[model samples]
Target: MSNSDFKGQIVVYSIVGCPFCMRAKQTLRDLELPFLDINLDSYGESVRKEVRERSGRSTVPQIFFNSKHVGGYDDLKALLADKVGLDRLIEEVKNNESPPEAPKVPDSSELKKEKIGDMDFTCELDEHAVLIRDLKMSGIIKDHRKGLTTHKNTFQANQFVDWLVKEKSFDDRATGIVSGQDLLDRGYAAAVKATRDGRFEDNDTLYRLLEHDQNSALNAGLTSECEARPASDLGEDLRKLILSLYNDFLTPDGKSVNYKGIAESSQFKMYTRMTAQLYRVDIKSATREEKIAFFINIYNALVIHGYVAVGAPTNLWQRYKFFNYVSYIIGGQLYSLNDIENGVLRANRKPIGSLSKPFSKSDLRLVVALDQPEPLIHFALVCGAKSCPPIKTYSGKDVMNELKLAAEAFLEGSDGCQVNADKKEVKCSQIFKWYREDFGKNDKDVAVFISNHMGPGEKKTSFLQVISQKDYKVSYMKYNWAINSQ
Candidate 1:
């Protein structure tokens, strides 16, 4: 429509992070049309239902120009393509007259497939109850007493939808909504409210399984202390939890882990409960051993936890963002994966290729940064990838030895180190290549470092012979970025 056709505001209901929504908004901006874009992602089911009812469609980017349905992005584009039609519609709106009804445009293919048949919730209530119990075991159900909503032993509607999508093979949020409504309708679950508003929401409305009493359940071997514990005790308890989780779910070779099993384990529940206590952990008073053991354990645990909560990063850009964004609150301060790795463990240095330091001069987490970077940590920190060192638990009391063992064990592996004596070449894990400065200043220093850490083996004998020659080249093996899943 012409700019003057819209005397009133145009309204577009959209979902946040949807590319189509972004394109629709950009189209309106280019046409110089005034529009209000309401992000449905931020709102509750009440607003979502209003959009669906008003537009007669569940899909987003639902456009309405002064009370006339303009369909979706495709319809808007088509309408704008016909300038005369747009101008006429605008004139009708300006004259306070209804415009002629236009033919409805078919919706974009983003629509999820409708379930083929109706499910009998009454007959399947027991099955759903078991599913709810699984969610509790998986740590999905918890106390969500944040901000104004003082919910207890409950899970958010959005979280339930996510669980259904991931664990139950529900194709989309629409199907999840259907299944959630069935749960409510069948009395398997209920909203934590006296007055219910909608069928099922993909928002922050709290839900509780009617069959289970999470509040009375025993702790899954975790300390019941939700408050702060001494830094030393915290590190030791975390170490045990990490070890237990690894033992239960790690692959035989320790090169991979059963992340899916971990996600559903009671140990994961314990870890989630334990993280709430991290906010009060006194990092400033932590001894060097405590800090090293705590942060390393925290980092490795967080990588697995993040993978369970959110899917693993699938590409380089996602890996970059994942490392930077996924984080935890410790001592009332935020520590991202990068912050814990480069800031706390690496003494506030920047990550490889990153220009800025992990912690700013004024950052509170700087207090937790080590006095000096520990190069041995390069071998201990597991990033949930195959090329990473095998996952292991470390004790603060013997962390120095544990780290040295980790380094030696890594060097003994084919992935970590290989020597080609005849060709006068030595290849090492990309860990050394990525953090070269941490290991040593020169190639020979790095080669010598490798030689020093290499365990007694045929490879070590060959590597040392090459190192003694002092003319061998050092290169990095191609690092594997695959998720180390068992």
Candidate 2:
């Protein structure tokens, strides 16, 4: 969506390098919003005195929304931690109104219990609740008394078995059974369940279970005969499903994901299954474009699945499991999102570094080059960022063509590389700069890459004409890390 949709007349009182003031404004700005700037410096002591008396604080950046005090940066961020908070602030400003009185913060004892299945539970000690559900569903407690209902045919049972080898260390607890009913009898699921349930809390292997490797891991619900089945089995269904999601829920012209609709759609559950199945495909033998296309689809599906499964990233970090924490068992190997992107998909061999971008979508970790990394994959992988390319269900047959199309679309679209032909320069997305190694070793190479991938029709003609002569300078635009959603 055009970011202007979030613009509002929220005011900021501040001076340069006053971190609280900067952060206060930035928090609003990060949501693709606009705010009124009341620079304390320009008005000097008069504005500073006004802010002190008005906000009851001497700080430079005493922020406001429609004249309602919003405290400083931390308070603003805390309010924004709840997704509805910003909307309230924006709405008040839009209507020329003041913020309504906030509901009283509930006491710890006032936490309401939620009914799940037949039990009353609160988020307090929620890990135990998840564990109880997992225990029965993973077939870890086949005796069927582990709180939640145990059914071999239930959804979580299938999901647990399907994703286990990919998510946890399986080789260490290998029981020789790879799939079928025998996999249910194996104790590996129990080990995983126990670990997550805190039975192994002090044991360091628990960490290793998630972060380390095992050699003789189970086939992750794949049997010798069924390994080849998933590639052909679910490919078409997933493609059609993903495309429908994009066509139905995503905005046509803006390509913004319909967040409310996605929160209600049933298609996301299929992504869990499809991702599991796709990971089993034999990418080693697939054409490079096919592999790239495969990962693109995989990444996009995984990202959408993440938002749907856990809700929107309200602040920055997810409250529940996300794509990077979730794993895929691919060809008997475990690959997290980090593993897939940097290690397997991209040519870069740097280890995937940090998960520290609590509110930012910019993650660039490195990995061992699993295959010949196709640079064009950058144009296709969507990381749920406003600055990133639109999600398209890519194809193996026309993956190369599809990659070009996506890149072209991005360049032509508002989110794509912006040009300042007046100064003999073009401003591109930070993706180009972040993964410059993928595009080229330096700026000159990057310029050539952009020129080559210019959009089609008049846009392409115009862009190329501008850059054809004097090696138009490439400046990376400030990337927008806001959620690319409605």
Candidate 3:
């Protein structure tokens, strides 16, 4: 059928946690066009079969402008680039020339409720126990001997919501309240007084961890201190944990990170617990290589954690907020993503667009800052974005070599560095432009650094020749901020 034969309907077949699907829907929203979103994940195989039969695609985010297939995200983007053509298609849809056939499956909202109803949230009882245990250990939820009434140990609902927002980075108090109710409903926590008709509140209503044989003794409120582990031991465990996560969810090439799977894994729950132990870890005694490896791993893992928990930042202001807001409490000091990259990794350098260094001379966290900057970390740290470098776990024993290899891999790619032999010009990733000071003082210096880091190849030969002749222009490639999903 011709494109005009289909009109007056827009359908998007998608799945939960798919970034491209979210982008497609967001684009529709921005255009002020109403579309029926169909979540394949919420439907049966028959529905998927129907979608495949109609759209001829098995992947998520199959879109149809009217009954005419618009393909996937990239296709939609290309169509959008042709404004006149897109406007014509939109006008046809608006005119309702011929109403297209509606899918037999329920829309996303109905399917969302159905899916939630199908979930056995009680299965997460043990996981929620781990979460509460760590929250108490971290002193976020103050378990007390005598609170509200003469109950043994209790925490307030407001305190729980605060932890969810400030520490866990839940979007708002409402979500935190809902999660709190889920904890209660799942039997991980119980109402101390059955207040508020059994609904979790954002007020000072009291609750207590449900006594389990596993942690009953630890709930006595006497041991409020975190269980101490040697910094070296914790660091090793952290490294292993990262490797396990990468092995299970990250692709071998590191191009795709299964963030949705990572978020749901038992390993991630362990990671959440381990962050509590970071409060007392002795970072000061670690060797330089140990510190580098530790912070690099932390930075990479935290980026994934932030995206899974808070979502990928969409704009420049949101990016600044994200880097500054998502943080960890290590060695009794709060270290933001920016702090780890700039303060610890970059030797307390000023962050992008910042007039001052991340840490002041008098700041306690300054003690953890490197004496000199390591420029190669820019390649090692993955920012959970498409344009960022590949994810890799590092060991302290071989971190320097690992960093070198990461830099080499990055520069070898067109996104990182591309040599146009005919034009005598070098095009580099915006990473070099953003952290230019780290690479060098000027364009020539940055070009030389890129050339040096590149692995031995014809591209390297061409770049080196260009540098030798001092006849090359350096330009930066536009950065893509899309989430790097599997």
Candidate 4:
């Protein structure tokens, strides 16, 4: 598409938590136009103040359609409120036949060498921005155009492969193709996933990918059997008791657990006894999956009890006594917060102070490797902190569904997984960092695992689409260590 045909960029400058900003971007997507969403929160207050001065408004989302101020969400709605006018404009932009004076991109029918990172590979793109083939790279066509330099939306070509291979943590040898529809719907990430499962040859234009083609090789190896929740009463009673605790003391948001109420409850000790009883059942008797669910439940229950037993302290993590000394006997084995988490659940078999890896040898190592290390365990296990997954009652029957929902909720939750479409980067929760190995040894593995669990939504679909189409960066959001309370 030529610049004249393009309606110009939709620039959204807004704060991180601003709902209006989110709505504004969503509206732009609904119109099928690519946008650069500038989150001022990433740069802090000073930058936000600068934006306030430039936009002549104290609040956001300040939106610009073709570099002209269009007020905020309300103003954009007014302009696009006319369906015919907007459609005509988009059609004109898409049909523009004028090409650039000097073609920086190759012709649709010719092959050319593009230097990406350390390798010089033959790559080509069709007239509609669909990548024909890279010959060497796996996922290609991360971007079709860049925003104005004043907008600072352009990424370096050299950093593309480096970020994908080194930081995004993909195996360099991995191969895949972004389907046309996936490239359009999901953006770069979804394209990467599709590419991981896609194939490209000659005559595949970017527009062709956008067309409906069930026969497209892009769908290959993308299908999997849907997992059903397993039925088992292995931890049913404990779940009921945990539910009571959650209903009575835990607020809906799960940020706060009323330790005082828990301590004062006549049945608090009753629930604790129930935990002890559950763990008394021989661990070997339960299936490995049951063990995984039960272990997570028991771990969480003990953590809650630890606080109530000593009066829930607001400044919980500051006290070494809370985590170090607190212990519980589960399945005839003793465990503390650090012990059960790293040594048992993770199979790392080492104390907190000393670094440990999954399956590593240590004195605390359990002989049986039943519940092997799972990345989702990080989301399930509550470490008596504010940022931990919300307190939930998990039974063997619903453990599968429970964990899936927890992950989805955590990821889609506030500041959970922030995707910077402009920069082609994603900021994920710190849980991925602390237990990165559990997900995979590298970024690519983590991305693959996440792509599987991310729920069906416009935002997530768009995020993954971008991921699939090109090289992207991944970083961890800062951890919140405060006690998670209401």
Please report the candidate that would top TM-score against the real structure: 3
Residue-level lDDT tens digits of model 1 in 324-396: 8787766545578898899999998879889999887766567789999999998888887767775555556
Write candidate 4's Cα lDDT for 416-455 as tens digits. 5777888887777777776677788877677767777776
Which residue pairs in candidate 2 have backbone atoms (N, alpha carbon, C) closer than 3 angstroms, thus clashing? Answer: 316-359, 350-366, 350-367, 351-366, 352-365, 352-366
Better of 1 and 2 by TM-score: 1
Per-residue lDDT of candidate 3, residues 180-297 (tens digit): 9877654355666553356887887767654411121111112113444445455545544654565456543334567678778876765665555564457877888888988887
Which residue runs does candidate 3 get wrong by more than 4 Å?
1-236, 239-261
Clashes of each: 0, 6, 0, 36
For candidate 3, the 10 contiguous residues with the lowest summed lDDT are 212-221
TM-score, cand. 1 vs. native: 0.53
Better of 3 and 4 by TM-score: 3
Better of 2 and 4 by TM-score: 2
- The true-versus-predicted C-alpha distance at residue 31 of model 3, in Å, is 38
Q: What are the root-mean-square deviations of the candidates from the true structure over C-alphas? A: 25.4, 19.3, 17.1, 28.2
lDDT of 2 at 254: 34
lDDT of each: 0.68, 0.51, 0.69, 0.51
Query: Which of the two candidates, 1 or 2, achieves a greater lDDT against the reference?
Result: 1
